[model samples]
Target: MKISRWLVAVIVLMSVSMTASAEYLETKVNFSERLSSSAETLVVLVPADTQELSLSGWSNETAAQINRAMQVREFTGAAKQQLEVIAPMGLSVDRLVLVGVGTPSDLTRIEAEEIGAALANHVNSTKAATVHVDTSLVSDVAENGRISASIAHGVDLRNYRFDRFKSEPEPRPSQSYEWLVVSNSAAEAYYADLQGLANGVFLARELVNLPGSTGYPAAFAEMARAALEPLGIEVTILGPEQVRELGMGSLYGVSQGSQHKAHLLVAHWKGSDDQPIALVGKGNTFDTGGYNLKTSSASILAMTTDKAGAAAVVGTVAALAAERAPINVVAVAPLSHNLISGEAQLPGDVVTAGDGSTIEVANTDAEGRLILADGIWYAREHFNPRVIADIATLTGAKVGALGTEYSAIFSEQEDIIRTLRTAGENTSELVWQLPLGPYRNVTSSRIADRRNTGSPGAQAGALFLQHFAGDTPWVHIDMAGNALIPSASGIHPEGATGYGVRLLTEWVKIYSAE
Candidate 1:
């Protein structure tokens, strides 16, 4: 009997749920004495600028065999370069994979971690059951745990993939493998931190990849509750009435056209007695350009990821809560859709923000900053956080300039900006500082307090959001160009990149670290 369309939909949906809801890989990380002969594969690391291809740690017999293979293959310890070697005789190890670390003098921790990811990808391709990684060449004895943890972080990230919709999926080679780091020092604490951070990253990815029908404002709010409330977070959701009562007109105006009700989701984790750090995210679950309407089908199709900022906030908070780190953090997301409807605000409509500023709607598509204005203001009025950071997939100009490589960070605080940049360097979800000059006049409106999208191009979105951040120490990350990747790279697959989740988590975790 032929399967009906509805049945196929049901089956696919079930598979997707099973795949999407899968727990983040808690890849077991354990220490080893050395690259043992009994291992299925022995991954040997070579430091940069080596004159000879000698196997440093191996005994005479093993070293001689590996030397011959390297002589033939020309294996150098240059970073990201790898070659597989097989010692036909005298070693218990089955295969020898040589990886380069490009000139130890210039190697940073971030580069070390990337080399680790490369090693993981190499082993994953061969489907090795057990791998012994030599970290001696990467760092000295004192830095072994940090280096090993960095490598483990890479290995953990490379293991994530979203492939649930395929009728017949390809086998994942590394799905069942065990990873061992050959460092004398144990890295339990570092691994725990990475696991917590990655948990948030994967959660963000899953939310960004979901379709609009399932990942709408209401559903997104519920998702946050399910993820955060269980981790001892106090999750509060405000509906239209509550939002309207607080005079969040800019937020309510954007969602007036959509059938899905809008909401503001606040998650508070008060691990410290001190004032909290506020994280505000723009949650346009789907952006259809509202009354303005998107011009291209491709752009419209990609609208599902419009809420990536909110997804990141959800993920970062869940991670912070799960780790139970001794830091107070509050994550706020304004969830709704920018869509076409009879009740939708028009192009020239004026809406007042929670802070009592009127915005003339120049473009309905520029709605992310609208809701976020309310969210940031709410965080200020309600929580009175010590610091405020808002993230959004808000503009096309930033993406147009930076592509999907690095996110744009606009902040007046150099110290805060420096902290996030360091996080990007460590995590590889990179960020670049951009200018937010005295261009307030460009966003000015003769009739209203401001125009939704003024002539500042991409910077206008950040400027509009800056109005609500006010005089507080604030950071705004415009992730429009950096939210989704076109293809698989490192830990991210061909969908949502989970751009700012790790960056934000690390940024917030700094307080705890201090």
Candidate 2:
């Protein structure tokens, strides 16, 4: 094995060369130098309802070519509509996708989310492997970052498919493409955080979309443990014995009918020891309406999604843990299913809630309020929260009144109400405050402390939950209207829409800073 000095030097140099090639420049995110730089597709966002076509990044000659193609295709830059051109002149990008923003200058976070979603849908349809977003139209890096992050979020949401039950599902095209938010300005950290938030949203959607047998109370507690406990959030799965010891009779009464034992999942993210913000949710995994059985068939079909409130809380708290939001947050998810059996609580049955408020069950179908009653009480009594926001799909009346447009929020505390409204507006998961002051008296029971439900009124549901809030600045979010998606739109796919995760996360982020 006699090697020459030149060969030995060459071998060492060759080893160094390989190592250098293996180790590429590391960054949180990578941006291309230009929009057309080695990109399979370049997307341009233009204002809708305008006669003039405005593609910001393109040159005058290139813009005229795009405009001419747009005119030929009868494209008016309408929202949700995209004009695609292949191999346009003066651009290295393979395809151009033009998405219309309703008004460019008046663009908000909601529009940005939709635009991001629109881009994802176009990419999937056109089968573009690599895509780049042109941020030239937007003025500042902050706005650009927001838009880019939103786009990342939209793509994350669109990628979700609940195909667990499909034994012979169609094979999807492998999405091996690198989705880069190519920009010259701003760091990609904000967009990266949005993707982290997306993980929480996806978790909520997964919980809500699961079959009742798989997503039942005990199963859900484990799901929360797997998702949250890893992130350093202290998760306590309270069993039937612990629930009984705490005297959560209202929750137990509604849930005992099912063979699946009830559980109260308590997730504590104690980033700060200061009085925590508490979030409570009604976790009705499935609702058979107990002794007071469901009168409508549609009600039975939608019962699996009864735990959407719990999912939202879990999602939000998990996001806070993942993002490491610098504040203490206590999330209480009370899990149960309203099923009919020999042990089922009948109408007129009375039980004391966790806060020791005796409640008369007027309709056994109003189990969400009963379960939530205990969860809210627990949050208040234990956490001693600065503010309590209790969320539930407590009433069909909310859906009837709001019609999938808004989640009806009822709060007497103007400050709490305003904070939630701001959060909703920021996330486009809108919340409209209805009356809670006058409606509170209507929920009072003659024999017991209060009735579980009142004439199926939307305001009555909030009023019923309010009894358990106990002097804490309380906001009851009746999310019945916004729980399910009729079809794919915005960041929501055609299934259980992850509603309150964004709203609560945003609210907590703002609330924590203040």
Candidate 3:
């Protein structure tokens, strides 16, 4: 057989291009005391209130060019604002990026992170293989390398991209980063802790961003076990038979229509002897709305991210365990798929949750609460924990109520509410408290103890789950709109935000300290 030279060349190019997007961007971060001037790219942090650029050591021509560029761009050094001078004459570095840190006194750890993320986004577009960031000018200095570590963590977070399944005309070539920063060993140690958090967030985002065909209930459970068990956490997965035997008919009903069986993944991390904090997540891998099928194209397309809450719970466990936090925590995720089949539960079907509370399936679209009903009940019954927090992408009303800026939080406990708000602020995964009392009676049903859904938006879903939470200090986080972003942001690209993992992990840290 004879082949033309053009055909062989095409084959080689096709093979290389096909495998280009298989790997993710790998970055190696290093910290040192000295700032290197001879580099491919150099990033300098400038405070907003500063009147002059720090060009004391630079050459006369290079400094003039930088000043001219800054003036033309009108760079005021506002927080996260950037001005780039490429290939300045007489300078060893190829690219010089002046990043604004706002006011020296007002710069915060969160702002530092945003700066890092913005920088990562800036560099991700270009082919800057090695970059150097000078953070010595930032006035905010604290122990455990808070500022530097935060910036490093932000860079790692924004560097993530989930384009694994895009095999069309070949995805973008993977870019590796070698991040060199001016700092000490303290920053390195602190970033190790933050690295744990970044790992968990990546895992959560990957899980949620996964397609429904590969992310079914049992597969999701196995992935969770693979991620958590090696970190010294106890991972237990209950199949459909075990779930049915445990009186989790409400959860079982949601999966009856799908070929994939429902699963209950319980992950426990014992860092201390104190009472554990139970996290229950609604793990609906794909919600087709069951008998009441989703009519909207957009709604059906976004159903794959319905497992964001479960992914967050699993990620939180990974984060805590990896960091070796001094807190006892247990994660309970009810995994299922709400698909249409002959055996699917219909409207008005009544099923018993794990806590013996009967629920009427008023709307098959409201399946997240059904699974959480069993999950929350299982967490409370078995662990008898100090507090129970349930997170889910449960309702569309939450999007209408709070929009995408914040997740809706519902709880009667003032202390828990305050703690959650603080954690949200710390992590930038903001939460707004909604009235829990008004929706308590909305889930009333004539046939069963309560209906799956009711009027007044997200609160009703929370109330139905509350029946299973019982008297435990519980907080229901309705992360409907916040789980997935419509477009790429500074911190996260356009996809699953991995919303609750950082919030829950920060909350655990603060609560355990108290």
lDDT of 1 by residue, 259-305 (tens): 87678999999999988899998899999998788999999999889
Measured on C-alpha atoms, candidate 1 has an lDDT of 0.76
lDDT of each structure?
Answer: 0.76, 0.75, 0.82
Model 1, runs deviating above 4 Å: 1-22, 26-29, 32-39, 48-60, 86-88, 92-94, 102-107, 134-142, 173-185, 511-514
Deviation from truth (RMSD, Å), model 1: 4.8
Q: Global lDDT for candidate 3?
A: 0.82
Scanning candidate 1 in windows of ten residues, the lowest lDDT window is 13-22
Off by over 4 Å in 3: 1-24, 35-38, 55-57, 139-144, 168-182
Per-residue lDDT of 287 in model 1: 91
Clashing pairs counted in every model: 2, 0, 0
Give the per-residue lDDT digits (tens) of candidate 2, residues 364-440: 98888889889999998988899999888877788887877789888888777778889989998888887766554
Ordered from best to worst lDDT, the candidate numbers read: 3, 1, 2
Identify the candidate with maximal TM-score.
3
Give the Å shift of residue 487 in candidate 3.
2.1
Better of 1 and 2 by TM-score: 1
